[model samples]
Target: MDGMQGAAGTVRSGEVIKPAIAFESVHLDLGGREVLRDVSFSLPSGSFGCVIGPSGSGKTTVLRLAGGFLQAKNGSVCVGGVPRSGPSRDVAVVFQDYGRALLPWRDSYGNVSLALEAAGVPRSERKDRIERLLTTVGLGKHLHKYPSEMSGGMQQRLQIARCLAQEPRILLMDEPFGALDAMTRQTLQDELLRLVSDSGMTVLFVTHDLEEALYLGDVVVALAANPGRVDRVVTVPLPSPRSQLATREHSEFLRLRRELFGLMQDGHG
Candidate 1:
């Protein structure tokens, strides 16, 4: 193993630390097709966990289980130590299709206001709260801009702003930056790290890119396709507040990349 290898345990130093998200012996079948089998993992509060694998590996399925959009036939999907019954305000999801996710008829403010409104935020305080959420995702100046008026990156930011309005404890992201240009994706990745750090929101991000998984995740969970199952779990040892340049250049990063690449080559995906 190139990096620290382990699953997130339930206890830390004799103290029970409940994970923000936990999947235990999870199995699922869609249309008589086994999508996932005996899948399990945990994400500590405020930690970034990335799930990576080939197409049809059920990466998004795993995140959806956490979001309560899809249910597992066996085992449990728990959030904040409680079994997920259905969608809750405590979990917010950011989809990869930013264009479809945002409202074309709504401006940035209105788009973000939808969440607060759904959460029953008061009409009197909506403006300030919306402004703050927009500002956090770097959309402060584009408050009046519609989805068509903004670039892809801006549209994604607006979507993120809306999700943040729910004040979620856990964030589920499904390849959120996969469609953006290289520079835009990198920029958004950094912004996401900053936002999560400030909010202390646990994240379960699904991606196909191995390098992206390593750079952004505290734990990179690789899956094997055709009934997706956990293949490897690598706990990153790179220092926190990772640098796009220096971190990638570090020997450990390169080593982990090769290791994961080798895992993919071994028919795990």
Candidate 2:
């Protein structure tokens, strides 16, 4: 309860602030099917927000909208107070499918270097930056390994390293750890928390696991499908840095889980 704190609603005294990401009554239609309906929420700077609900609840769509990969038909999605037009260097995404997200042809080092290349970092500077990024994600020794040779967790870590190479201010993660086993998933969850804390990056994570959402989020936003919309937004009051066992056993965590489970059940019914 005392290592680090979730910054969801905290503001320093006398500090006027704006949300890092804001969705204003947003509406979206994909292939004539409404995916999101009048959805709205705000993530404070440097806070971790988790989006959760029943399957097909537009959780990934919301992340995509925030990342500027998709546009809303009505209302607005803004980052740093500006309307999102398209993909920006300041934002990076970590997708659930690391196998697809990573380039199998490239080694770990080369994969991370791709970001630097896209950013136009000179050839001379790419080595140190790429090495640092891969090392930061615990891929230091596996730098020469291709995606096909790495384990699922390692590939996901490499994907994250590639994202970090962009030096993004905002990170959009769509179930990035869903494919891993429980232990690997928890390990990556903690790693992600540490990385975000160190970098002060605003994160919007989408996950179907209730415990995973509660464990990583500063605020949990529940959406209801059949035209996904915000059904509830609960601020996590638990202290950080959270532990896999202890935090999960915390009274508040259990309470929120029960509440979210009911909401999700209602959403599906």
Candidate 3:
């Protein structure tokens, strides 16, 4: 259902009129070095999109641009119909390094509650919301556990819960699950799909893992290195509620994987 249905009797709205996030002919130069070039694409509201590319391809730089950490030198980066030139509360970023994303001294709940607190959410509401989010990410039992005491996967879940606390229009993730073990990574992937679908929030994730990108993204945007630019955008044809074992065997999944691999190969040229 993607969790947007509000009414049964009334014909549901065709689609919510959510604003677009896009890069219009964007170029980025970091400290005199060209990082991204002519990058442009528009993501529909509530859609999950991914940007994949080779090492040093500026994939993370694009995420920064989207998060307003870096501004485009040649074109523009827009979020919800306004030009985003600096960090704003409307955007939330989840980085690969949980150690950096999380506060070292805070427990899981504390980390998430702080974000809600900063937003001026009532203290009572913050506690309730933090509990719900930790539970949603399967961390309910570990709410009081500090990051140093938790496993890598739990730390990552805490990071996700913190992002959810912000209630941002867009979630920007840079290789968020890349550091976890295979089994933990897959488990978190399923949880992420469930969370994003339930929340109906837009996500722009960056990863070099082709399989991870296909598994999580509604549309996968491929890029090339050495002055990165969009190479192609591929849509995942597999239906929702995708499972690790079953989805790998789906014919459409295999086909899409092959096509994306070919495109990535071409991009490396």
Candidate 4:
């Protein structure tokens, strides 16, 4: 989030985790319209950060640049300290459309194995890893179930398992929980926290929900819509081991919520 971040992130005891994702004066355009301008931010290693904005704020565009699906028209976008021009195995994306993200014909096991297959993993070494990933995502019992057989949450979980199969160092999630019911969304949020903590992976998540961003992020980056540029970068000071009930009810959370709400509405830093 900031220089030598500790306590909340993986860097500790004078250790410094370099920014896994750095966008320096990044500029992008599509179809003759400037989408982003002079955008700059860095996500510290093992940190969970969110990008929030209204429509046309370039939130998804930022994620796409980070994931190497797009490149900056000016300046630089780097992942794992290297300039991103294309996709890498070190980076994996989990999209908002869990339904379309998964293969309809592939069972849970088959879907999870897709990543390994793309990487040319041998058939012998695939089963144990796939099984472990499915279990981690709470899909062990549904290993053979097709995408159509699972609920929205389960489908999302399977997609995550498939992504994790890549053994990625950074996870780029674009509102991966937006489609689920409230109860299921909260459940997946907690599960994601646990998963990230255990894996110690750096995350750059994009969401329009302020509460969701605050709940999951070590830092929140707010963008203004016109020409899509950074408005503010809010560091989360809420205590670690964040709980849905306690953290949401905390004064800090409320204060930050108000702060971001005004920013989003006012379209200013």
Candidate 5:
């Protein structure tokens, strides 16, 4: 928890604020099979946390539990110091498959507007909010285009724009960039970091890529499968506003990448 001191909580004079998300010895069973066991971690308010592990390590399940889409068989998942009983508007999720997440018939503007409508925002207020959200995700000019008409990256950006419309306090992403090409993935990664930083929203992102986890996370939590559980937590000391090139080239980044790679390899073997 060395590097976690500053990122996990607000330190004023000397006290640490409560974490924005907390998993307390959480356990889960899915389809009669044990998925997560005794998993625990905490993300401080406005910090970015990444979960990386081999396939079937319950990475997505962790995100689902955090979002209240699934319940833990034992233990608790808490947000803002309260045990989550169900999904709250304060939390939003972005999935890997943008094609399915978005409506093929709706244009980017309509898609983002749906969230505002659901949130009960008035018609007069919805336009500006939707426009701003879409622009924030770099979809300003693509407003009238349908999901089917846009590229994979644009669709994903639209999905994120819709989520941002929720004004969420926590963003849960499940391998959101896994489907994009390398160039597009890196661009979206930087965009996501900027949006999260500016909005002061906490994020819990799950990915199979070790380097990605290190690049975007303030803390990287590695889970081991076969009754998935927290294996280790590494504090990423990389400076904020990380660059795709310079940050990856940093000695600490390389060091942590190697460390995490070994951890994952060992878990698999």
Candidate 6:
């Protein structure tokens, strides 16, 4: 495999780590129906790539493949150069349904701490990191609160906090904010942008919302439904510390969004 230079000059495995995630000639089939066909792309390390398409277009399937949840029937799915066969320990997933994902018995802090315990981080350091992660996600006050005790927004934050404990190389998010209210979803999107920037983790996000994908992804990938294949890829050119107001008003932002919307619509048709 030839290595391609990633952004920031980081060397991904196989000599190039620029694209932290890559799917080469990949295919998937379930129940005699082809889910994805010949899908391919590269997401650089420390960058964000969001998958967009119509419902049942295999957007989630791509993330699952990258996370090792679904295996590619053919081709290679690699993270940092190594081929992925099953779920890689270096990857962490945050799903849309935070309530169902988190253990009901555990409080916010406990949920995050469980991951740390598995990682063998010392108790003292684990405590410190958990606090930091929770605080970073704006959940410091809810540290002791259980899922039932917190709002939908806060519980999603807890899921993110737990994923942070492992400090995964790639963070795979599957419509994490889709179930939240509009206001809450916006707030979480802001927090997630900051989190990805600060943590320097490669992110592969799955979403059906073009606006959301535009807001979060360094590159937005649109997949066609029914065969779930890559239709187009658009790179986001917004400046850092992207504020909602400034980003929405930026010329390039609007351009990219319009372009992405067209691409998505094209895929749908």
- Which regions of candidate 2 are displaced past 4 Å? 1-16
Which candidate wins on lDDT?
Answer: 2
Cα lDDT tens digits for candidate 6, 1-269 = 13344533454344743468989989899999999999999998898999999876899999988999878879999888778888855899999889899999999899999999888888888878888889989988788988999989889999998998888999999999999999999888988998888889999999998888888888998888888889888888888787888887889988887766766676556
In model 6, the runs with Cα more than 4 Å from the true position are: 1-14, 266-269
Weakest ten-residue segment in model 1 by summed lDDT: 2-11
All candidates: TM-score: 0.92, 0.93, 0.90, 0.92, 0.93, 0.91
Tell me model 6's lDDT, rounded to 2 decimals.
0.87
Residue runs of model 5 more than 4 Å from their true location after superposition: 1-16
Per-candidate Cα lDDT values, in order, are 0.90, 0.92, 0.86, 0.92, 0.91, 0.87
Candidate 3 vs. true structure, TM-score: 0.90
lDDT of 4 by residue, 3-28 (tens): 44655465343235447999999998
Candidate 1 per-residue lDDT, tens place, 30-90, comes to 9999999999988888899999998878999998899998888899999988898889998
Which residue pairs clash in candidate 3? none
lDDT minimum window of 10 residues, candidate 4: 8-17
Task: Give the clash count for each candidate.
Answer: 0, 2, 0, 0, 1, 6
> For model 6, how big is the CA root-mean-square deviation?
4.2
For model 2, the run of ten residues with the poorest summed lDDT: 5-14
- Residue 12 CA displacement from its true place in model 2, Å: 17
Model 3 sits at a Cα RMSD from the real structure of 6.8
**Model 3 C-alpha lDDT per residue in residues 1-269, reported as the tens digit of each score:** 43445453233343344345788899888888888889888789999999998876789998998999887778988898778879877788999999888998999989998889888998867778999989988899998999999999999999998988898889999999889999999999998999989988999999988988888888888888888888888888778888998888889888878877876676566
List clashing residue pairs in candidate 5.
8-44
For model 6, the run of ten residues with the poorest summed lDDT: 1-10
